[model samples]
Target: MQRLLDGIVKFRRDDFENHRDLFKSLKSEQKPHTLFITCSDSRVDPNLITKTLPGELFIIRNIANLVPPYRETPEYVSTTSAIEYAVLSLGVENIIVCGHSHCGGCAACLGPAERLNNMPHTKRWMELAIPVRDRILKEIAKDDIEARRWMMEQANVVEQLKHLMGYPYIYEKTISGQLMLSGWYYIIETGEVFIYDKNLGEFRLANG
Candidate 1:
């Protein structure tokens, strides 16, 4: 906590003071160009990874970075609402669903259900990745832990992109070429980013 407080003070004295004009411009309204969705992992910093400034990328962070399919339910829908606002109100042109290597949420989704039984909300939220888990289990060897984790992590990004398209407005915008959808896998240790190529049906190094 003290560390965070000290960082805030440093930010005010240094970073904020250096970018006072930029911050001042953001006071009234923001017009971000992209909606970046990713895991709520401390290691995965969306702004840092993308090298985006404040008010540049509207972001949504969640467990596993899952996107539930569009559905009308009488339930609290924070992620869905953020998606709607980013696309419709903010007019973000791109939506990037990024999943990372060695993600705890992804591991939990692929792990034994009983392990997450105590974490009911987390368990339920993980259910969103069941389809990806099932596909991986059917084809990948149970003993291949590394292969399974990597495959599931990439597959989950594609799965979330599908869910993002399930939103009516998002679908319309995408088809009309008003919005673009991208799936990215970030390798935590290597600092490498792989982008999903729809035609290749695989993630290729972003630089490639």
Candidate 2:
């Protein structure tokens, strides 16, 4: 807690002072260009990775960075609502669903049932990745942990992109080229990001 407080103090004294004008300009409204959705992992810093400034990337962080198919319901819908607001209200041009290497959520999705049985809510949330788990298991050997993990992580990103298209507005915008959707697989240790290439039918290094 003290560390967090000290960081805040340092930010106010240094970073904040340096970016004072930029922060002041954003006091009223924000117009972000992209909707960046990724895992709520401590190591994955969206802004740091993308080199985006404040008010540039509207972000949504979740357990597995999952996006449930669009549905109208009275129940609380945090992720769905954020997606709607980012696209409809904020008019974000791009939507990036980023899944990383060595994701605990992805591992949990591929792990034994006992791994998540204790957390009912998380277990239920992870149900969205069940198809991913099933598909990867058939494609890779059970003993090949690394291969399975890579497939599971990248497959989950692709799955969420499908879910995003289920939203009527998102689908329309995407098809009409008004909105661009991308699925990215980030390798943590190597600092490499592979983007899904629809034409190639696989993820390729962002530059390569």
For model 1, state the Cα shift of residue 186 in Å. Answer: 0.2
Query: What residue pairs clash in candidate 1, if any at all?
Result: none
My TM-score estimates for the predictions, one after another, are 0.98, 0.97
Summarize candidate 2's per-residue lDDT along 104-208 as a digit string, tens digits.
Answer: 999998999888988999999999899989999999999999999989999999999999999999999999999999999999999999999989889999884
Error of 2 at 148 (Å): 0.6
Report model 1's TM-score to 2 decimal places: 0.98
Model 2 clash pairs are none
Model 2 is weakest, by summed lDDT over 10 consecutive residues, at: 199-208
For model 1, state the Cα shift of residue 121 in Å.
0.4
